[model samples]
Target: MTNPYAASGVDTEAGDRAVELMKQAVSSTHNNLVLGSFGGFAGMIDASILKSYDHPILATSTDGVGTKVAIAQAMDKHDTIGQDLVGMVVDDIVVTGARSLFMTDYIACGLLEPTRIADIVRGIAKACKAVDVALVGGETAEHPGLLKPHEYDVAGAAVGVVEKDKILSSEKVQVGDVVLGLQSSGLHSNGYSLVRKIVADNNWQYTDLIAEFGRTLGEELLEPTALYTGVLNKLLQDIRYQNKFSTMSHITGGGIAANLSRVLPAHVSLDVQRSTWQPQPVFQVLAESAGINLFDLESTWNLGLGFAIVVREDSAASIIGSLRELGVSSWQLGVIEPKPENAESKGYLSSAKGTHGGSVRLVGEYAK
Candidate 1:
């Protein structure tokens, strides 16, 4: 019998084998909530728990690894990309106070390598497990001519659930709120486009950089994205704690300024003290080597702060203490201020006095 699918470069056997491998990898992330394994067109989760809430909000976000994939490919590391994929999507949902319930991923590549694909899936499974989210389903496509050999693009969609009344938005933010900064694990999958160029221009290789860390560059960059789920989950369990948490921001592309501003109420402004923390050495090296302007570093890369928590100033100390107790590094990076006289222009961000080496505003300006 002649097989028409193979003739079109779609090998059913190859896909089947790939699916088997991915299924095994994904199974490790499953829990009681996951209805099935890898056979369904859409991932299914047990949403029966939502029936208890009077008003439930379903939050969803889709994102990719972005240019960070090039770095993973250039370095031949596949494991951490899955974490990056999950982080990018789930983080966006969490900003609205949603809890990630389930996740699905999509990977398209020109050629299929069972081992490589399995590696990516393993990473995804690990991240999903960390966030207590189930990997319900995913798609792996083999398009030989559409993409470059050994090149694959990864994207995923995450669905989260929250009580409608509990959704965190700008309206909840107040002028007297304190902005707490959460430390990031270097770059956290964004700004890699600039990182790549800087590394290339400076004649730096992933191997050279990893040697300094006493591990392979792939190992470091592949360090799974920090799963903030557990921390935030604990924080939200206590009513007292939840009330203090006004707004949250996930610092991704467009860096701190842009992302932070997204959660700030229009009636308030934020004054960030740049001197509150020092830039990580990796950022310093990249900036000096590439001669990147300070403004670019702050607005483009995270400058080491990955997440921000906007909370009432009175509870700032306790919140920081609680996060520290959880072994998460955090600090008071800034404070919320009253808006300027011009009501329309009220919600503007400013650098605190003596911060950013006294060039705070210029250094943290929005990147065009």
Candidate 2:
């Protein structure tokens, strides 16, 4: 009465039950644009929507949650990690000023615990619904021999559409652009390898009560990443802001300067003023514990800002004001200018990500 596949390792029944438990949450994210029902081998979305565009360009991004998953596993928490996944994947699509259409996730785990798998997908569905992106389909792969039962990883791909002319990039950057920063919700989903190292070296428990955070260390670290798609897309939809912005930077693994460099032209140089903002308490604590200087932190953590928008200087006030109204704490982080003559001597990084781009440097000191 035993199937050979089940006998070997894969649990077909558990996978099915995980799908069943996650069906409602997943279906909740789908709109009429999502064609076909769940359980389809390949997900379908109505591409006819693109006909309305003059020149619709598709933007696709794939990303994983990274070592932050270790914290989730350590705390036995899975729900909030999905938002991190959505933020890592869909936000990249939105960086191109694209409207996210749909997303698919893949989970690789040694054993498929139906409830745990359902929790992860439910989180993904919740985040997708927030951004109005359909959760069309997903897969859960069981790797019994390669991974332990409790060990797993999550990644996803997002699809979005933007008019060709509206695509934001470094090519649109002009002199005197105002660089605005969007606040992040804790560490988001990057640099957790170092975060874990700090925690382990200090022998800190995930449940350790830290006064600065006012919550357990694990809760603070596991705080869901902020979703920029909904807010950024909302800003893009407003006619008043048309053609006022050039490019955006999503501060992830590369930190502020490196990621911002990804969207800059070769001739531009930007010095992100650290005096404009202070590192969050969590960052401060980690830095103090690790005895590393602010520069090292800058290369790893987001510090405070999670996303940045480079806009025309004239629109700086209005854009930051709009972000405030949208409940996003934003500030003028810096300005774009002609490349400084002393950029190389000043240690500006133009090719941090290995692309031919503008130079960026973190200058001054973070406000105390």
Candidate 3:
């Protein structure tokens, strides 16, 4: 028997095998809330949990691994990429003071390798379990003609829930509010296009070892993004910390100043000090190797801080101490202050991602 679909480059049998291999990992993320089983036309999650909230708000976000997928693909490592996807999508939901309830992922690839697909899904399932989110459903589409074989990209969307009154909108930011910089686990999956450009320009090999990173270039670049949802959820649940944090920025594509600005109130501004903490050596290595301006690097990648939280000045120490106990290094960037009539700065990001809210200015010198 001749299979037209296989001839057309879509392997149905491989897809079935991939699904079969992914079964255990997927089922592991499932809870009693998940309805039906895998392979259903659509996924259903029990929404009864929302009834507990007087005014529940549904929060959803969609995001991908970005060009960092190239690093995973380059290294032939698929496991950690799923964690990165979870970090990107669910973490954004966390910024709204929501607890992720469910998630779905989409993978488009030129070829359907059963083991590879299973590995990616396993990572996704593992990460979902870590944050108590269910991997309700997902799709793996093979686009052989549109994409080169061995190439694939993964994206996912997460749904979370928060009580209306419990949402942290950053409107509470005041002159005495403290800005805390949450340390990142390396680059954490943004600005990879520039990273690729740097590698290509310098003729660097993925196998090449940079003394500063203490690992092969590819390995250093592939570090999975640090998951913050569990930590945030814990903070929100604690009596001492509930509503203590008014604003949080998931420092992604816009770098520090821009993402931080998205949460600032119009009446105040934040001065993110560079000396708060030393940047990871990866940034210094890339900056010196690329010979690019530090500002250019700062505007693209996180440099060091992965997440920013604005809290009442009195709560700053406790929050930092909590983060430390949670195994995340933390420091203060600056304090919130009233926006002056004549606000100007040599280094500032007024707005980003079409957000024209409060502004942020970079100040102080690097610790080197």
Q: Write the per-residue lDDT of candidate 1 for residues 208-272, one digit (tens) a residue.
A: 75434567554555555666776887787767686788879888877676677667755566667
Per-residue lDDT, model 3, residue 309, is: 85
Number of clashes found in candidate 1: 0
Kindly list the per-residue Cα lDDT of model 2 for residues 1-368, writing each as its tens digit.
Answer: 88899988899999999999999999999898998989999999999999999999999999999989888888999999999999999998988999999999999998999999999999999999999999999999999999888999999999999999999999999989999999898788889999999999999999999999999999999999999999999989899899998999899998888899889998999999999998889999998999988678887899888999999998889989998998999999898989988788988988867797899988898999
Tell me how candidate 2 scores on lDDT: 0.92
Error of 2 at 87 (Å): 0.2
Q: How displaced is residue 320 in candidate 1, in Å? A: 1.2
Worst 10 residues of 1 by lDDT: 353-362
lDDT of 3 by residue, 309-336 (tens): 8888888999999989988888989988
Q: What lDDT does the true structure give each of the candidates?
A: 0.76, 0.92, 0.88
lDDT of 2 at 199: 96
Off by over 4 Å in 2: none
The global Cα lDDT (0 to 1) of model 1 is 0.76
- For model 3 the TM-score comes to 0.97
In Å, residue 134's CA in model 1 sits off its true spot by 0.8
Q: Once model 1 is optimally superposed onto the true structure by TM-score, how far is the C-alpha of residue 36 displaced, in angstroms?
A: 3.3
Of 1 and 2, the candidate ahead on TM-score is: 2
